[model samples]
Target chain A: MTFDVEIVRWHAVASWTWNAGDDVCGICRMPFDGCPPDGKYPGDDSPVVWGVCGHAFHLQCIQKWLQSQAQTDQRCPFCRRAWEFKAAAPSS
Target chain B: MIKLFSVKEKQKKDAAAINNPKQSAGELRMQKDMSELNLAKGTTISFPDGKDKLLHFEIFLKPEDGIYKAGTFHFDFQVPTSYPHEPPKIKCKTKVFHPNIDLDGNICLNILREDWKPVLSINSIIYGLQFLFLDPNPEDPLNKEAAEMLANNKAKFESQVQAAIQRGAYIGSNHFPPCR
Candidate 1:
C-alpha cells in the first residue's frame, strides 16, 4: 500500500489594514484600507496622512480639504488647528 | 477548508456596493453621513423626494426650550453633488418671525456659509439650526426688522413671534404662516 500525491505550486491569500486608530478617513469617510473617490487604488495610491493634531486622513482627501480653505487659515478639518503633516510614523 | 471562491465573490459584491460606478463621490459621502446622522432631540428628518433621493430632504425642528418652543418649523435641505465639500443649502420652509431666518426662508447660520468645512457632517448642520432657534442672534440677522425689534424691545419681539406662530399674522408687512 502506498500514497500517490505530489505537490506542485502553492497559492496563498492575505489581507491587511492600516494601523490608524480610526478606521475611516474623516474627509471622504472612506475606510483607510480603501482609496478615496479621486484615487484609483488603495494603500500606497491613497496613503494615510497624519496631522500634528493626531487625526489621520487619506493624503488626497486632506490635500483637497486644505485647498478648500483660505490660504491664511489652513487648519485641520477635525480639530480646527493649523494643518501640519506629522513627520514621524503614526503610533499604534 | 477555506471556501476561496465564495469568499472572493462576497468581496466583489461588497466592493461594488461601496464604490458604485453610477454614484458620484458626493453621493457616497452623503450616504455615509446620513447613515451616521444623530439628529437633535426635537428634530426629525424626512426625504420629500423619497428615500432614493438623499440629496433633497426636510428637517422638522421643534425647539423644546426657547422662544420658538411649541412651534413646529420646517426646513428644506438641498445637498449639492459637491456636498461635504460644500455645505448643504438650507432654507426655513415654514416662515416665522425669526431674526436669523428671513421672510424668504434665507437662513443666517455661519456654518451654512463661510464657516463650513468638509469635516462637518449633516448632524453638525442640524445642531447649528437647532441652536439658532434656541438663541436667535439679533446681531447677525437676515430679518432686519425682527432684529431691530428684538434688540429694542424684548416684550414686543415675543408678541411678534407669538402672533406669527399662532395666527399666521403679519408682522409689519410680511405675512407668516401659522406653524403651531
Candidate 2:
C-alpha cells in the first residue's frame, strides 16, 4: 500500500573527450561519441586518432584538418608541434 | 546603455539558444571560451546571428593608443566545429590601411597560419589582432605598399593612417571603409 523508490543503479556515461578531459574534439568541436564532420557513426568507420601531443580526435576530423594543412606542412592542431600519429594498435 | 545579462537572464537566454534542439560539443566549448574571455581594454564582442550560432561572431577593437588610436575596427570570427585545434577564420570586416591586414581582409598573423596550436585560446587571437592595430608589422607584409611605407617612412605611414581615418581616402587605390 506504499510506493517506495529504491535507488540501486548509478553510473556515469563519459563521452570520449580529448586529452584535456573535455568531450569535444579540439579541432572540430564535435563530441567523439556522436557523428563526426563526415557524418559517420563512431566505430571502425570513424575511429578516434591520437596525436603525440596527447590530444585525441575523431579520425575523420584530424584527417580533414591534415588535408587542409598538407601544402603548408602537417602540424598538431593543439600544440602546433609536428603531428606524429601515435603507434598503431595491434589488430588481431 | 547596454547591460550584461545576469545568470538568471543568461539561463533564460540559453534556453532560447538551442536552435538545433541538441547542443553540440563545439557550442559548449565556445560558450566556455567566451565566458572566460579576458579581452584587452576597449575591445567588445558581439553575436551577429543571435546566441544560437555561437560559432560565428564579431569582435570590435578600438585601441586607445598607438597608430590605431581612436579608430574602431571590426573583425569577423568564424570558429569551426574543430575549434582550438583549428584556428578561427579571422577577417577584417572594417577595411583599414595596415601592413598585416590586406584589402580583402586577409590577415598575415603567424598564429592564424602555421603557428596555430590547440593550446592557443580565443583570447590569444584577440590580443594578436589588437597588436596588429597598435604596432603594424612591416616584416610580414600583406599590403606591400603599406608595409613599405611603415618600414621605410614612419612619418608618411602615420600621416596616411590619419588621413585615411577621417575622410574614407584611398591607400594605393584600395579604399578603406570609414568605421569611426
Candidate 3:
C-alpha cells in the first residue's frame, strides 16, 4: 500500500506531541492526558494506534467502534481494514 | 553503561505490560462484542491501519436492490471512551442523494439518535441503515421536499430517486454533489 508522506508525518507529529495532557481521545475528542482520578483510560496502558492512512485512537476505542456495528463482518470504521486485536505478549 | 541498559530494559518491560492480555474493562467488553459481529453479504469493514490502533475504522455498504442499488457507500465510525453507554458517531463519507442523508453526508438514522440503546450492537445499526435505503421513511423526513414528493406522489419520488442515482440533479432548492 502507498503511504502519504504528509499524512504520515502529520500523524507522527500528532502521536509524539500528544502529552496525554493535551491529547484528546480520538473518539469523543475528550482529553486523555491525566483523566479524572476516578475515571480511567479506556485501554489502560495499551498504546493508541492510528490506522495506516487514517486518524489515531486507542485499541480499545477502535474495538468498541467495531462492536457497535450491527453486523459481525464489520471492519474498521475508518479505513475499512479488517479489525483484528493483537494477542497479549507472553509473560516472562 | 550499566544504568543505561537497565533503563532501556525497564522501558521495554513497561511497553510489554501495556500490550498485555490483561486489558481494561472497556476493552474486554469491546473484544467480546467485536468477535460476535455478523455483517451482511455486500457490507465489509476495514481498519485502514493495522491491528495496533483501534480507534478509527470504516464500513462499506453496497446496496444490491434498493434505490441505492449498484452503488457503494462508506461510513466512518469513531468510538469514544465511555462506550456501550454512549453511541459511536458515524458519518457517511460518500455523498449520496437520499431524503434521509443530507448534502454534508450526515445520516438521519434513528440508531445514531434518540432511539439508540446501550444494548444495541453494531450489527443492529448496520441493518437499520440498510433498511433505511430499502425503505425510506417519509414520516421523519430529513429532506423535506423528498419526503413530500414520496408522500404525495410515489411515481415522482421513484423518478427523482432514479435521477439522483443517475447523476442528474433533482428539482430541490439544494443541489446534491454527484455520487455517480
| Winning candidate number (TM-score) | 1
Candidates in order, TM-scores: namely 0.84, 0.64, 0.56
Query: What is the iRMS for every candidate structure?
Result: 1.0, 4.4, 9.6
Which candidate comes out best when scored by lDDT?
1
* Error at A24, model 2, angstroms: 11
lDDT of 3 at A70: 56
> Per-residue lDDT tens digits of candidate 3, residues B1-180?
999999999999999978886444444435545676788888898878755445467889877786777667899977654555477788888766567877677889877875664446677778888998888888877777778877899787776666665675646665544454
Evaluate model 1: give its lDDT.
0.86
- Candidate 2 scores a chain A TM-score of 0.65
Give the root-mean-square deviation of each candidate in angstroms: 8.1, 9.0, 19.6
Pairs with backbone N, CA or C atoms under 3 Å apart (clashes), candidate 1: none
B37-149 in candidate 1: lDDT tens per residue?
98767688899899978999999998887777778999999898877788899888897888888878999988898888888999889889888988888997788899999
Give the alpha carbon lDDT tens digit for every residue of B62-103 in model 2.
988887788889899999776755788999988888889888
Misplaced by over 4 Å in model 3 are: A1-92, B1-26, B167-180
Which digits, one per residue and each the tens of the lDDT, describe model 1 over residues A1-92? 99998999889999878879889998889999998988999978989988899988999988887887788988888888998999965666
Q: What does the lDDT come to for candidate 3?
A: 0.64
